[model samples]
Target: MANIYKILQELPNLSFEEIFLLQEKVTKEADFRSKELLKDVENTILACPQCGSKDFIKWCKYKETQRFKCKDCNSTFLPTTGSSVHWLKKPKLFLRFCVSMFSGNVCSLKTQSKEFGISPSTAFEWRHKALIALGQESPIFQGVTEMDDIWFRYSQKGRKGLKYSRKRGRSSHKGDNDFVSKVLMSKERGGELDISLIKIGRLDKSSIEQRLSGKFADTSVLVSDKHPSILSFAKSENLKHETFKSEQHGKKDIHVQTVNNLAASFKADVNHVLRGVSTKYLQNYANWFGVKEKYKGLKDKVKTIIKDCFSNNKAWDMFMNTELLYKDFILKKSKRTYRCPTVRYRKHQNWNFENAKRGTYI
Candidate 1:
């Protein structure tokens, strides 16, 4: 305190440019002092994120916050720059959000918006962003892996034509001409789980192979239901495959019960906790489910989430590239069935002069 007071006492006698220079020097010294104070407390070493150099010096301060300059790149940056939350405002709120998600607190976007005093859009974006980070961090599936496909209804919530369909509850059976979304899931018993929501039209052998290629080790035994796609995938990959009719009991070393149970739990979570997620963002929700299941048993899950939030820069890039456009969210004609007859629909179309001007008819 006396040294700071002496420095303050000498500052008033300096000119404007000299005062600026002195301020920079004081900031550097303060950074050194802070490093000295924290040397024994924090052992985590921080290197230059850009150049990967440790040869950096304190450059400036912003309201008592010290910034560093990389000697190799001659670039200045805050510690949070290049991190997942680099562009995030209200970081404390985001931390709290992470804790809530990690602790399995079932909070909706509306609830989060109210609690955090942010808009629902912001809450939705933040949730997906965190899910992206956690999804990228999901461990690889290995050992006795159980793989299966689960289905969710193609939903277009908060959009027109929702009233035409049944509100809430599962979609009609798969063969009923109802739109269904497919999710491929793999679980290593007592290990990691992977869930991938397929955006492509159907869940065929090719789609499964494309999405899950290189996911499992050749030596890892895969247990699955007798679905033809799964069987074909297992055969094509040359993996040791075991299959059972989904309803049949396991004979000895063959069953997809692990992934089956995981699928059931994941569906229940989406149905009850999330109150149904939109089909467009369903992949992100599935990712979140995988991450939640992955980290559920860890004692330091919160710490792990926070650490990943800072370190997973690629996750941020993934989140940025994930499109939330209306076109992507809307159900396609291939996934939907027209209720009315085509002739009758065309006859009843509201064609007008405006439609002619637009060179189209409804």
Candidate 2:
């Protein structure tokens, strides 16, 4: 406080040009800071982030913030220990980055990178960190859950080490399961949403169960197009099921139109706006989509997303772990057999296209 006052007192001694520059700097700082998480987040963080215990106490100050020792977990942690900003080098950039990330407007990584003066990789990483953190708050589907499957052409947009030309162009045409990535989108009537990337090359009962088994409430009614996988999932979960043919959506009250629209918009953002993303980061983008939908029409969308980035501790672990496991998944199980760049498949593949369908010939 004293330092701020002292600095202010010196402003009168500066030339008009210097004063103008100073004002510009201050305004920019204020703009970014307004979007930053407030220090009062400490009050809301009454429990230990690790063990969810309320008995933690401030043990010390580190990096200008309070660090506490959890009584139950016997672990030391900062308020943001489990959050996206936990390991961030530049905390000031969080909310500013989120404005571009969670906004209704589309921002490509390159554009964000240029705008924010960050590398494209840093932009990508930061975007996913915020997304994966927010994904921790999965909605519990209660009543009238609309469900549907949306597919993206298989992509390994950022993968390396290919010796042959990658697959490119329109795929998923005429049921090309071998080159498509499957995603399951579900939304309850109350606006609770779940959009998950199931896998490459098929929407199956097992995949739907993996994303939605425990998400639906006991009394929740499942609605969808008559995809056998959806029916099988509803049966397996013992959920009250209602479905219609894709063409018969509006004829009766039964429809999955809510989630269907969500899927289309999400696909536009992922495939068109961002010009397509890598298969590995598809789930992160899905979570990002959830962030937008969850807070749509709400004020302080950036503020809410910033708090979310600080709230979820487990998401950081999962995001990093998934990166570690990506090698094996892309190599052995990605179903990107033909032009895959992960391992030598006895197939020569020259890879290109930042937006390829597994980077194959379209």
- Candidate with top lDDT is 2
True lDDT of residue 249, candidate 2: 66
16: Cα error in model 2, Å: 6.1
The TM-score of predicted model 1 comes to: 0.67
lDDT per residue (tens digit) for residues 1-362 in model 1: 46969878887788989988877987897557444433321233267655568898888885555677989999886655544465676766776677676676656889888877889978887887777655442345568998877877777664444337646765545552447777788888888787876543456787676567777775588888788788888888888888776567567868877777888888888878888877657777776676667778687666665565555434444454443222332333135532321111222222232212121100
Q: How accurate is candidate 1 locally (lDDT)?
A: 0.64
Error of 1 at 346 (Å): 41
Please list the Cα RMSD from the true structure of every candidate, rounded to 1 decimal place.
14.5, 9.0
Clashes of 1: 0
Cα lDDT, model 2, residue 144? 88
